[model samples]
Each structure stands twice: as structure tokens, then as C-alpha cells.
Target chain A: MKIFYELGRYWIFLAGMFTRPENFSIYRKQVMLEMDAIGINSVGIVSLVSIFMGAVITLQTAYNLINPLVPLWAVGLVVRDSIIIEFSPTIIMLVLAGKVGSSIASEIGTMRVTEQIDALEIMGINSTSYLVIPKMLAAIFITPFIVLISMFVGIAGGWVVGELTGVVPSLDYITGLQSEFLPFNVFFAMVKTVVFAFIITTVSSYHGYYTSGGALEVGKSSTRAVVFSSILILIFDYILTQLILI
Target chain B: MIQVQNISKGFYGKLVLKNVTNTFEEGKVNLIIGGSGSGKTVLMKCMVGLYEVDEGAIEYDGRDFSAMTKLERKSIRREIGMLFQGSALFDSMTVEENVMFPLTMLSKMDEEEKRDRANFCLQRVNLDNANNLFPAEISGGMKKRVAIARAIAMKPKYLFCDEPNSGLDPKTSIVIDELIKEITYEFQMTTVINTHDMNSVLMMGDNIIFIYKGEKFWSGSSKDILNSGNEQLENFVFASKVMQDLRRHLKN
Candidate 1:
């Protein structure tokens, strides 16, 4: 019953955010601020994680394909497919679920407890639209770009590591990366990234917006937002993979 | 003028404000005074449409505010300004930006005009030098004053302040009370303040409503409050020993 109640309330929240913004100029500025926070600020950490993941995947795949019968370029093919289909979209987003998700929840929860949300409402602003919609828009507009950067960096890291570690030669790895690459896999990954982005922003925002009490409750809401967003990302990753690949 | 007609509100099956009916007059500082958890804040929230009343209508001028659509309510809300207990200034914004927020969001004023209006409001609140400071950087009294400046920046018809002096020194509280009264008169605005500060009530309450346990216990002017002789009202108004001593002195 509580789950149903939350679900209904979540849908209503989404509905509330869909209204026309009272001022497009203010919303546009808000979107830019959020985009900077959600996208640009995240690049360093995402890149750091993605590069390491790429190197590990390359080394692991090369070690496993010890059979001389498997072409050396298979290392590249494996790394490319793994990063595109799973690592870039799923792992990076899961990392963001912890990073960006917690920030959104804590920021909004503070506002809720301090009556800032109430202040906005009294100013004739649709508080939900003013606060959450810009965040959602920022994530939707920017997360895919982040994923694309992660994919490129991950593949480049794999290439660099393979050549340096003698896991696979650069030419063979590059050949394998180019061989049998399915464009649809990239499309599938992008679809997952967008969906996960929506989940991260909205789920965190929801937890924060309704938060009551003081600092302790804001901490709890932040933890809940990260946990819920991570769980949803994993759930949707499986669902999207089955729907798209199967 | 704002009229609340028998409004009632509850939260989670607990009735917090019950059949509270009153009028907050224009061009005066109308005050709602009560003890902690007396539901004065809830009543103010209902008047501002932050909390929907469980029963009865709130009228702003002649329009039935409670019955209006969300779109219609926006029109009413635009004419309303509020100072929250915690000040509620945007943490990310500077004082200048906070005061200018309504003008930036609700009006098509140019950058220069918005800045000018923000400067004027800040100056009015005696916060001219703190424009670039964020809410966190300022002291509590400055934050309250900044919130008041923001509240009045839109030139609202109604000003609602919830506990504007909660954490202030007596001197700052009096300053805030006098500032609110001056703004109310200067703009001919209906100002409704919810406070437990008896000093504020004595200073700026042109009209006063006392709530006890979610009910409207009494209503009268500031002058009448001294001699009203209502037990509950006296207990609340003269709760402090200083006030009680003053009352006895005055009676003698």
C-alpha cells in the first residue's frame, strides 16, 4: 500500500512538472546551471573511472582469450562491445547515481526543510516545475553526451593499455574494434543512458522535495535517493538489454 | 484586505487549525499571536495558499481564493509576498539576486531596472552593503531583513510574515517590526504576521488575533490587548516575568 501511494504520488509529481514554465528566461538560466552541475562538473570523475575500467577490461579479455586460435583483435572487439553495451552506460550511470543523485537530494531536501520551496510557491512559481524540470532537462540533454565521452575515452584507454601491456597489438586491437561493430549497440546504450538519467534526476528530486525535518532527515533522503536510483538503474539496464538485444 | 472565513486545516488526521475566521486589514500590521504549536503558522500558510484549507473559503479582496484554479491562484499569489521564519533566501543566490528574484521571474523588466529595484529594496531594509553576500554569509538578522526586502520587492498587495523575529535580539526584532509596519503603511498593503513575540505584538500589532490550541481564542486591537482580561490571552501575552511585572506596574 505504501508502495502504491508513493507510485501515485510520483506520477502526480511528474505531472506537476510538465506545466508551462512561468518564465522561460528564468528556466533557461536554471537549466544552464543544472547542466553545468550535472554534466560539466562530472566529467573528471566519469573519465577517471571509465579509463580505468577500459584498461582492466582489455587486460582481462586478453588473458582469457589465451587460445592462439582466437585472433588477437578479439581483445579489441571484446573491449569495444563491453564498454558500449554495458560499461559506459551502466557503470558510469551507477557511479553518477551515487554522485549527482546524492547532491540533488540533499540540495532539495535542505530547501524543503527551510521553507525555500514554500517561498517559491508563494511567489506564484510552480515549485516542482521551477526546481525539478530544469534538472531533468539538464540530465536528459547532457547525460548522453557524458556517455559518449566515456565510451570514446574507454575505448582509447583500452587501445593504449593493450599496446603497452602487450595484451594485443595496437593494429590488431584497432582492427577488431572496427570489425563487426553493430551501430544498434550504440543506439541501445544511448537509450539506456537517457532512461537512467531520468531516473537519477527525478528519483533524487522526489526524495528531496518532500523531505521534512532537519539535517538528519536530509542525510537520510540523500542516502535513499542514491540507493533507489542505483537499484532502478540496474533494474532498467536488465530490462532494456532484454528488450533491445533479445 | 484578506478575509479568512472559518478555515480549518489538518495534517495526518491531526487538526491543527480549526474554524479560524478573521480579517487582516489593509495598511496595518495585523498579527496572529500564539504559543508554540498553537497553529498560527498553519493558519498563515492557509491564508497564503501554501496549505489548502480542509474547510471554508479564503478571500483576497472579493475573489474566492480557495475556489480558484491553479492558474487563477497564480494571479493571486503574484500579488502576495511572504517572509518565512527561516528567511528562506535562496542559498545559491546573493542578496542582490535574492531580492531581485521576483522581478526577474515575474516581470519583463530589464537588467538595469531589476538591479535598481533590488538595490532599492535592499536599501529600504538597511542592507545596502550586503548585496553581494549569500544568505549563509550574512547574520540571522540580515537574512530576515533580506527576506523582508525580497518579500516586498514585487510590490505585493499582501505581505505575510511567519515568525519574523524568532531568533533575533530584542533590538533587531523591534527593528524588523518597525520596518514591517513602515512598509505596510507606505505601500498600503495588508500585512499579516504570525509570531510568539509579545514585543512585536505590542509594537506593531494594529490588530491582533490570538489562537490557542488551533482555535481563535480572541481578537482585538493592541490597545485592547492590555485590558481585555481574557485569561488565556493574558497568560499568553504576559507569559514573561518582565511583561507580567510591567502589567502589574501599569495596573497600579
Candidate 2:
């Protein structure tokens, strides 16, 4: 019952954010700022994690293929598919669900507790649209680009590790990467990235916007934003994969 | 003028404001005084449209604020400026930017005009040489002054302040109270203040209302407050030993 209530409230919150902004230029400036915060600031961590994950996947794949008849290049195929189809979209977003999600929650939650939100409301500004919509727009616009970067870096990491460790011949790995490559898989990953971005921004903003009490409650809201966003991302990952992939 | 007519509000079925009605006249400092949990803050918030009243109507001049939709209320909201208990300055913005925020969002003024207006407001608050400073870097008194500057930047016709002197030292509280009073008279704005600071009540409450446990218990000027002859009002007004001594001296 509480869950239903929360879901209903979440929809209302989303609806409230879609109203016409009080000032388009101010909102545009805010969107640019949020893009920097949500996307630019995140590039370092996403790249670091993707590179290591890709390397590990390549090495593990090479190790597990004990059957001599199977081509060594199969390791590259596995690494490429894993990074593009799942790792970049799902894993990178889960990382962002922790980083970006917590940030949006804590920032807005502090504003709510301090009455800055109340101040905006009293000024007749749509606080929901002013504060949250910019973040949602930034995340939706930039997360896909970040995921694309992750895909490139992850594939590059696999190639670098394959060359250095002699796990598989570089030529064969490249051949495996080119073999059976599906353009639709990249499109599917981007679709998932877009969905995850929406989930992260909205869920986090909802937690922050409705936050009551003081500092303790703000911290709790941040935690809840990250937790709920990650959970929803995983849930939707399965749902999207079923709908789009299967 | 702002009129709150028989407004009531509740949370989770527990009443916070109970059919309270009052008029806050324009060009005067109207103070709502009560102890914590007495519903004074709630009343002020409802009047500002932060919380919807469960009953009755809030009117700004003749317009029914309670009946207006959010879009319809924007015009009135633009005329309302609020100073929150904690100052509520945007943490990410500098002091000048904070004061300029409403103008940047709601006004058609260009960059130079907005900057000049922000500077003028900050100067009016005696907050010089602090424009570039962030809220976290400023003292509590400075923060309050900056908040005052921000509130008045739009030249609002209605100003609502919630506990303006909450965490200030008595001397700073008096300074804030004086600023509020000066601005109220100078701008001729309808000023509504929510506070429990007795000093503020006695000093600047041109029109005062006392709420007790979600109900309006008394209404009068500060001159009349000392002799209201209401026991609850007396108990609250003379709660401190110093006030009791003052009351006794006055009686003699």
C-alpha cells in the first residue's frame, strides 16, 4: 500500500516538473551546468571502470576457452559483445546511479531542508521544473554520449590487454571483433542508456524534492535515491532486454 | 494589505492551523508571535501559498489567493518576497548572484540593470564588500542581511519573513529587527513576520497577532500587548524573569 502511494506521488512529481518554465534562458543555463556536473564530471570514473572491466573480461574469456577447436579470436568476440551489449550501458549506469544520483539527491534535499525550495515556490517559480527538469534533460542528453565513450574505451582496453599479455593474437582479436558485429546491438545499448538516465535523474530528484526534516533526512534521501535508482535500472534492464533484444 | 480569513490546515489529520483569521495592513510591520508548535509559521506559509489552507480564503488586497490556481497565483507570487528562518540563500550562488536571482528569473532587465539593482539592494542591507562571498563563508548575521537583500530585490509589495532573528545574537537580532522595520516603512509594503523573539515583538510589532496551539489567542499592537488582560497572552509575554520584572514595574 505504501509502495502504491509512493508510486502515485512519483508520477505527480514528474507531472509537476513538465510545466512551462518561468524563464527559458535561465533554464537553458542551468541545463548546461547540469550537463557539466552529471556528464563531464563522470567521464573519469566511467572510463577507469570500463577499461578494467573490459581487460578482465578478455583475459577470463581466453582462460575459459579450453576447447582447442574453438578459435582464440572468440575471446575478442565475447569481450566486444559483453562491453557493448551489457557492460557499458548497464554497469556504467549503475556506477552513475551511485555518483550522479546521490549528488542530485543530496543537493536538492539540502535545498528542500533549508527552505530554498520554499523560497522558489513563494516567488511563484515552478521549483520542480526549475530544479529537476534541467537535471533530467542534462542526464538524458549526455548519458548516451558517456556510454558511447565507454564502449570505445572498453573495446580499446580489450585490444591493449590482448596485445600486451599475448592472450590472443591482436590480428585474430580484431577479426573476432569484426565477425558477427550487429549495429542493432549498439542501438539497443543506447536505448537502455536513455532509459537508465531517465530513471536515475527522476528517481533521485523525487527523493530529494520530497525530503523532510533536516541533515539526517537529506542523507537518508540521498541513500534512497541511489538505492532505488540502481534497483530500477536493473529491473528496466531486464525489461528492455526482453522487449528489445529477445 | 493581506487578509487571512478563517484558514485551517492539518497534517496527517492533526490540525496545525485552526480557522485563524487576521488582517495584515499595508505599510506596517505585522508580527505573528507564538512559541514553537503554536502554528504561527504554518499560518505564514499558508498565506504565502506554500501550504494550501484546508478552509477559508487568503486575500491579497481583493484577490482571493486561496482560490487561484498555481498559474493564476504567479502574478501575486511575483509580488511576494520571503525571508526564511535559515536565510535559504542558494548555496551554489554568490551573495550578489543570490540577490539577482529573482530578477534574472522573473524580470526583463538586462545584465547591467540587474547588477546595479543587486548592488543597490546589497548596499541597502549594509552588506558591502561581500557580493562575491558564498553563503557558507558568511556569518549568520551577514547571511540574514543578504537574505533581506534577496527578498527585496524584486521590490515585492508583500514581504513574509519566517523567524528572521532565529539564530542571531540579541544585538544582531535587534539589528535585523531594525532593518525589517525600516524597510517596511520605507517600501510601504505589507510585511508579515513570524517570530517568537520577544524583543522583536515589543520593538516593531505595529500590528501583532498571537497564536496559541493552532488558534489565534490575541490581536493588538505592542502598546496594547502589555495590558491585554488575557492570561494566556500575559503568561506568554511575561514568560521570562526580566519581562516579569518589567511588567511588575509597569504595573506599579
Task: Name the top TM-score candidate.
Answer: 2
Highest-lDDT candidate: 2
lDDT of 2 by residue, B1-252 (tens): 999999999999999999899999999999999888999988998999888999999999999999999899999999998999999999999999999999999999999999999999999999899999999999999999999999999999999999999999999999999999999999999999999888898899999999999999999999999899988888898999999999889879
User: Candidates' DockQ values?
Assistant: 0.91, 0.91
* Model 2 error, position A90 (Å): 0.4
Sequence-dependent TM-score of model 1:
0.98
lDDT of 2 by residue, A1-246 (tens): 999999999999998899777788898999999999999999999999989988888888999996999998898899999999999999999999999999999999999999999999988889999998889999999999999999989989988998899988899899989999999999999999999999999999999999999999999999999999999999999999999988
Q: Which stretches of candidate 2 lie over 4 Å from their true place?
A: none
Q: What class would a CAPRI assessor give candidate 2's docking?
A: high
For candidate 1, the per-residue lDDT at A170 reads 94
